[model samples]
Target: MKVITKILLCFFFTTIFFSVHIKAIEEEQSIIIEVEGDPHKHRQYIEDYHPLIEVVQVYDTIFTGIALKGKASNLERMGSLHFVKKSYPVRTYQTNINRSVPFLTETDDIDTEQMKFTGKGVKVGVIDTGVDYSHPDLSANYKGGYDLVDLDDDPMETLPEQGEPTLHGTHVSGIIAASGNMKGIAPEADLYGYRALGPGGRGTSIQVIAAIEKAVKDGMDVINMSLGNTVNGPDWPTSIAVNHAVDRGVSIVIANGNSGPANWTVGSPATSPKAVSVGASTPPMKIPFLEDSFEDKRIELAPLAGSKPWDLEKEYPLIDGGLGEEELPNARGKVVIMERGIVPFSEKARKAAEAGANALIIYNNEEGILQGSLDDSQGPIDIPVAAVGKKDGQWLMDHVTEGEYWIDTTYQNIQDKIADFSSRGPVTTNWNIKPEIVAPGAAIVSTVPGGYRELQGTSMASPHVAGGLALVKQAHPDWKPEQLKGALLTTALPLKNGKGLYNPIDQGMGRMQPQAAIDTETIIYNPMLAFGKIDKLKDSQTVDVKIENVSKETKTYHFELPQNTHGLSWQLPKSFTLEPGDKKNVSIQLSVISNMMDKGLHQGWITLKAKDTSYQLPYLFINREADYPKAMGLEFALKTFSKEEYEYRIYLPEEAKSVTIDLYDPHSLVFQKTLVTLEDTEAGVIEGTLKKRNITENGEFIANVEVKTTEDKTYNYQTVLSIE
Candidate 1:
């Protein structure tokens, strides 16, 4: 009896110790892990040994990979397995919904109304956060696809409560195949949705690879991945997988990323040499307005994330809420105007709601209108709230000397320019020109899960190319992926920010002219020219570019270099002609203006002028000897303006002796010439304010902040500002 009791006690203590000691992983996270040799074999190996790890999806054709779900401890053990090549946490992508509808391509003259083809029979795969397969605009053309996220047949978008649902997949699909009144670039193309990303717009690279392998196996003609992470290299697993897919005859178009205006920000997969990485561009002319009884002020209004739209027709007394809770007595039944800074936007809106206000307006204390969100807290906001540019908000506060001043809200058409937030590049390390093409991305309207909505980012831009590529493929079905990419690159239009040519880094090969791409007979084989880095001033390099004549007729071409922009000198062929189906390789030699250039990115364009068309091929080389920030290293943010006085926080690695700040009108792109220079700056967060100016107009502008060290090296940081 004593021996039996001791045995039972030992068993009980062991069970209790393990239950208490071992951390219970209640919520399992998904991951994609690559394996040596074959993923199927490796998966079998995991099932045999790492029994706790769940193998969800496996890829064998394009690459050996598997999707997994398991506890943190089990996942770590699985990663350590002998057969595992690599394991990465699944990441989510966020939808950058900032705009509304499909006029983007019309501006490029790629009108489907006049086109002979609408991507009929072309199978395009969208590897994203799944699509709303039943969206009326997309259903007719949806050919069905796989959902890697749920391991199901129906690839539908699912939104999580705590996460912001990315309507990205649906939006991208619409760009490729939406029909009816809102026509896509490829209005008749067949779309397959591969739901790799979950509702939160997040997915692992391996899952994406699995999707690519599936799409390739399913015989997809084109794959659109408007998703990426900041890997900035072509050797990443997803990039290798994408390259494999391309080799298997599928054209892949990826978003260059939305981390733009900065150099070397092009993310992975898009970093793949064969992929058509896209960027975003805005229209040239836009008219922003706020409806008012006195005058409809042309102002840039930033809407809060969860704030309901105001009832524009209703009129109510507008009261200033800057005096805080103590002044709530005067804000009853009115639209309370609160100054931003001390309290959070949600808190301010809540206070206004508590004060019995009908609506809320949070004005900036600095230069621009603020983009606030009432989403940080749970539950619905009771009042309609909006943010206005600082200048306009202040003018309203000062001009309303009488009672019951009410401002009405209305939406208007805004111009297309490079969105300040759009990702820029010379891909990292390689310094290759990225964002091979730009498309309308800002305020773009497309299909959401249930209906249509506007989302911004390179995500929107890539689908435009995907849809456009469908048209291209339909036009030249015999062309390979690179050839189609070549045609588009050579036929694209150059976009400028009003001041000067937008650096190639900001807008690669410029915007896409889809019609021109379809009509072009000649193609440049080397779409991107990366001179790499010229560490020494005297270094000279040579590269050969191949051009092909795709048309039945013979074509003549002459290559010319744009007058040396960055101390770059180039040799171009005087003239060359290609017979039908003929290919020609031309050698070009490049040398730096060695003595003339300071340490920075030096670039130039080589234009191939054909009989009826011309193509711009951009080339860039960096100087590393010169002390310059790694483009992404410099960070800064502008504060809301109070009157003409505004401030900014600039972060840098090296200590700065002085800072030279310049302002430019984003519309004009012209330097304002008024320099706000600061001296004796420290190494860390350097803050300074712009003195009050006589500026009264409300619009968007750019701050060209420059930091200089005692060594005379200069680094620049650019940011956008709104005058409310």
Candidate 2:
């Protein structure tokens, strides 16, 4: 009797231990639970016992899952219950948004009224801050959506009194389906709103994951998430969620990041490998050119912030304010030209304004034309202010001594170029060439809450691709998410900057061409090749790319290798044929001889000339002198604690080599003392303290963070930290 009783007690203790363990895990946080059993059975069980488990969304077909908000302990308990498979805490997500007329041309003028595919029946999900569905441009196609932020059915982007409003979501929605005034890439596509991010343009990861699962469940053809956070690895929760969504026939597009001019800044979701990560590019300047007739030169004119336009018909007397010279006699009712250097542009404009000048022009000391912005608080000038390029301004000073010159402001057709602020890549982990493509992101005009806005960033670029995807989906209704992605990538146009051929690390295939993608009958299966880091220049390194002929007619493609092979070279077949509806894998060999190899990143494209048009595939070979340091440029908003003290966030992907935080006066162009210097610190993120030095006056101050990695690569990121 005693032996039997001991056995029963032992069994009972084991059961209680596991139950307690599972409860502990579930009690930690709210998690989404995926079950392998009948949806009806789980629904009944949830209804019967777990009253706190509020099922936000449910999927029965594509995958059986339930998005619930409950205690982590309870969630773990549910996992052990009948039918439950897994449960994990929800991951956070943030908002990302952007023009783009030339991008429309690149998309084959999809912005035009007569485009064949308008994404009429397709459902595109904008899973971000709730969208302003009431906006005239989006009202027609706003089918309806869910608001995960407020746990409501109406997914509306409501505005707050201060800070970034629902402008991001509204802007992203406009880029995909806005019509009437501000045209979108696919104005006729049906838009499904998902309010994951809240008013401040941020939301927890779980909210975003739930939204993605819900969008897939709702059968969204394409989903655009112009939001992300810096993630170290590809196995991040958001990345996994995106790949899972893609597996279930939903196309996902994400913004690579705005942390640009760097090597590996591609953030999570974009690093998913399945996602179409987009980067920003500058379209033709929207500003007009001013003719310097004396020098026979046409100089581009970028208006100063808070400046007015001048009447072009009248001519004004031009005066030269010597270097660092703003005050001059006979300057009233005349245009003053000041050379850049020795003083801030605002100060120059202020001095010129004080001297009673009619207008002000600051010539650049550097290469390109400078975009000047005068501080409004510095006092109003009541006259127009503009910037001129270095070369033209120098010529103006040398040629026109004294004369009443009439400046002609005429428009010019300039080619699109990569935006300097747009993030670059060689993605940190796999070096898999981020920013699969570039789009017009600078000065992009789109819808806001009450009116329209012209915003810039990778945030703006992602929507262009998202809108393009809707068009591609409408054209090929049966194409899978991967197929749609491959079509857009393979058919893109190769981009080159002022510096010459842009590396594959800078642009994946190139800027996207949606019109060509829709009309093309053939496509490449592989997105791009990332020959990560080859220590030695072997005889040859080869990768296989599968080509598919989706058309009814057999197609022949002739291979063309890059002419200027610096160190890398490819051996391609003279020609290849793909029968209708057939797929063939071609082995392209990339060889690098010992003498030709370089230390830094080596990148280029392999072009395939088809009968009608050509397709290009990008490849990267990174042979760094030293192992590249892992670093992430943080995105943070400054919060003021007091007049002297302010708090800024330091969110790092990995420990920094050293970080220096400093404050600068924009009006005076004075660099204050370095607030803090951290060396060999190992913290993922922190609310760092910054104290202002000699801040006698109260206004806005610019806080800059300079991060130097172990590899000597420096990342300079800044934000406006003000004392209100």
Candidate 3:
């Protein structure tokens, strides 16, 4: 028996190596091809047509497609084949996890114990770095799962002997259904792991899609994926797969990417219109801020991960430490301020600690506040380090230059505020409001591989909603996936920022209220309205809202009168009654006068009253063609197998007439050469490869992307690209 097991393991490792070796040998690019007919037959057709192309995997459950690897030219030519519908490059994704279970449940006044809906019998699949099922907290409910990366049934978390150890999946799983000391929201739910991402918490699109297909085949009731790439297109392959999974009767929850405080940062899978995308919000906590002793102006401080907490109690003199790249002047028992550049954040923190500094402050080089983490590879720093925005940093620098400046620490008890790092969105093409809701993600403690740890991200927030949905599913087993989603969105608590209510694009209907969702008798589909761009005067758009009376009693619904605003008029449906268990669709029309309205994004909320309960539906519209980026998310990298070949991808929100990428010397600003150009490019992601022959030099170059839209308007975006 031992000999047989050893032989099987050796064969598995060899198969994995051979698969990777094939792609590394040639200038082959991995791609997922959506097919018009059967995927299995399509795979065979691809092989017969392009003899050298290799089909890695076939998916049919969630998405009908085939993953293959071939030379760029061969792959491009395959697109012209009659059977092929569309092709997407297999982009890489990383595990992006956890938190206070009671914070989430208690915030909504949910009594899981009394409700008797602890997600019993619900099969929740977690697609991430596999779970550590051996942990005592997860053993009972850890049913079974598959490892897509290793092509095996044992979906255990990556161990040290493997490439890079991971605990992300375990943390997420614990948040969903752990039954031991660290109780999850859905403690009795059955847990299944789908190891899409392997070592280093990284994997390609093919693995993720295969895992989704497996989960669908396994008849999962709910799926939670805390992994995503930085591509924001709604039609991206992973996002499309998510939509298909929802159509197959599985509730899916995804983490809105952690690229936040900026619009259009929400990535794929989260961009899926049908998936429950979640953003990170703070649990009740006393957040620390830095205040100037003289002016009493306080600046919010986000502590760097892996650093000591900012808990200073006394005022300390502030000193400018330049960039903190080299040895600093003698400074002891004072806060050292550094600019973010040249040196790594961890290195600066280490230098500051070595100089006996009490704390360190690093400010952004750009306009917004810096969200950063210290590199743990260099070991941990002893002193507390925090980040501030560029304006505050400049103010501190000026104060230090003129006279002695003393800074004191202050604390503010905050709750339900959106995390600065939480990605915001009005998804590019479709204009849907992503992160349809928010949840407590900041400073959440959950199960890790060995024990418990506190972590925070939208990755953590997503599982909260997933677990909440599991409870809702247990209460209403007959509800469709759409109904399950509506329960959460329509009943969420609308949150507010310092200025006022957060925009619909930022908070959607707002923070999740699990108890309200479970007890509500009505479900509002399309709870967030996105009336896309209105270009002409007196232009009108209508959205049909689906409302279901899921209760035992008949319900009458009516819309509240919106505040009068110039240039916009709304046509609302009359009060109507729905019989028990019946659903109705009502149209809401909005007419806009472009010249009378401000030419920018306008947003607000519409209230709907059903019986004694009322729900707030967030609404948004662009008065005219707003100045959103024409082209963004440009990525350039050398092919893993061949250094001489480079692959690039850029996102076009709308169809463009032409696109061009030009390179120039970073230092001298001298024109190098045009990298690539395409005509009549579609509105999704455009990917291609560049050969070494096209470039005369190798090093860092500034990439200037010029995009000409079909409307004859041009927009430019710039980023740095490197060649070796």
Model 2 TM-score, all chains together: 0.68
Better of 1 and 3 by lDDT: 3
Top-TM-score structure, candidate number? 3
Across 376-406, the per-residue lDDT of candidate 1 in tens digits comes to 3356677877777678788778845555576
| Candidate 2 whole-model C-alpha lDDT, 0 to 1 | 0.69
TM-score for predicted model 1 compared with the true structure: 0.71
Candidate 3 regions off by >4 Å? 1-58, 64-87, 96-99, 107-115, 157-161, 319-333, 341-357, 374-383, 401-404, 635-649, 687-700, 722-724
Instruction: Give a tens-digit lDDT track for model 3, residues 611-689.
Output: 6788888888887777666776566665434446667778888899999988766656666788888999988878888
Candidate 2: residue 613 lDDT (0-100): 78
RMSD of each: 15.4, 13.4, 9.1
Instruction: Give the residue spans of candidate 1 off by over 4 A.
Output: 1-31, 43-56, 68-81, 88-113, 160-166, 283-285, 289-299, 302-414, 564-567, 625-724
lDDT of 2 by residue, 1-724 (tens): 1012222222110000000112334343334456787877787778788887776666664346666666754554565476765333223356642236444644345464336877788899998888888888889989988876656688877565523466688888898888778678888899999988875777765567778877887789999998886554465667778888898889999988766666665678788888998987766665557675665778766666446554344566677886645357777878788888888776777777778888777788866436445555555657777777788788778755755454555665555577655667766546678888887776677887777765667888898899889999988899998899989988877788777668776777788778878876888878487766665656567778888998899889888867866666678866878889998888887777645666767777767777867776788766644233333333222221123444444555446688876666644536755556788756354345445553344565555667776667776655444443
Report lDDT per candidate.
0.70, 0.69, 0.82
After TM-score superposition, the amount by which residue 604's alpha carbon in candidate 1 deviates from its true location, in angstroms, is: 3.7
